[model samples]
Target: MNAGAINETDICESGSQAPAATQFHDDAPAVAWLREAGLRPTRQRVSLAELLFDKGDRHVTAEILHSEVLEAGVGLSLATVYNTLNQFTRAGLLRRIGPTGSRSFFDTNTSVHPHFYLIGEDTLIDVPEPLVLEQMPNALPGHEIARLDIIIHICRKSRDA
Candidate 1:
């Protein structure tokens, strides 16, 4: 090997490779997730999935994801992000949190649990443990409660930490 030459491992580890073209294939775990979710793992989808899954469970909005994609230099549009997020939600890959003032958050943790929504900061924080409800409200006349979701709104303290 030449003294200043790079190898495949170096290229792969450098984070400079073309993400859409080289990072994931049909056999990749993210790709498998798409397949399980009944989605086609296109290059763009794979790239977005990589970002969403690389970190642990998280709550993100389309706008936030668009910023992230832009920072990563991924050539994607906000509309595309919204579309992908909606598709992921419908396919059960993600859970939609809320439409807080025309903005919705997509939660990677799809399990049933409570969340804390910080009002001032507009952030969503997951509750570490499951919350047990003392009593569930009775379903309306002819309807049944399919699920129960509780969101506690919080505000910043007056004094600084």
Candidate 2:
């Protein structure tokens, strides 16, 4: 498979695209979803989409997605998972959150909002609603801020309380 290709199962005669079938299967909605998002729906892409969309909006890291794919009986490498994720993000189907430490979490919800990052646990959850900034900050001399991300760090409550 090419570095940009996700699945080797189904490929067109040109050796570059997935077959565009009109029929919709259990996974067909995922294919359609990808297409609507301007992305080719390959086997791997559809499978990953199903997992990512199965439980509604949720955040997942590439490692977590890789494990889920393996548990789902899908044969996919970690690298492929990473590539597919980046593709999906670029296509605007998902959102990518930083290397807080070493890895990033792919948020299924692409809308702009704040998130709660659990320290030590390395987990993230939506903040229920978008955060409200009291005052916006001014960019430096030649730079401009494109967006803002408010991540709140949380920890377990004291056992006594």
Candidate 3:
């Protein structure tokens, strides 16, 4: 995996066993953003929001975020992180992408776009340009296509040509 890439599936599945308790300062911008999204700006929510949005656009899993929160000296449970992320997703503040049933990634950029998932590196990268599909498959009788999610998986080449 690349530097800073989180490949620990165990941690992702099971949140931190124990987290230290620490005080968190209020983040004005995060509070405002949360309120605008119709979500209450609780201390935990504000703290997580600040960390998640401080960096531009990026992808993260619950475990990755939980680890970051701990590193920041914040006292938050894995469950809390999961709940907050789900709330953000429901409010359209984030987009959830599940490459497989067992793993999911939260994208800070809500805009519609494709992504490239590095197989061994366990990282997700933006595709840069929009993809144009030449044809669309017909939806079932009364069903309609809500949206399209395309993720291209890439891996390293072998040592031998």
- lDDT tens string, model 1, 60-125? 999999999999999999998888887777676787888376768898987666799999999998
TM-score of each: 0.78, 0.76, 0.80
**True-structure RMSD, every candidate:** 15.2, 10.3, 9.6
Model 3 spans with C-alpha error above 4 angstroms? 1-27
Q: RMSD of model 3, in Å?
A: 9.6
Q: Give model 2's TM-score versus the native structure.
A: 0.76
lDDT string, candidate 3, 1-161, tens digits: 01113221222233322222443346589988877887777788888999999999999999999999999999999999998898788777888888767888999987667899988988888997767666667669986555556799988999995
Best by TM-score: 3
lDDT of 1: 0.74
lDDT of 2 by residue, 1-106 (tens): 1112223121121122334444334456898898898776777888999999989999999999999999999999999899888888767688788738687998
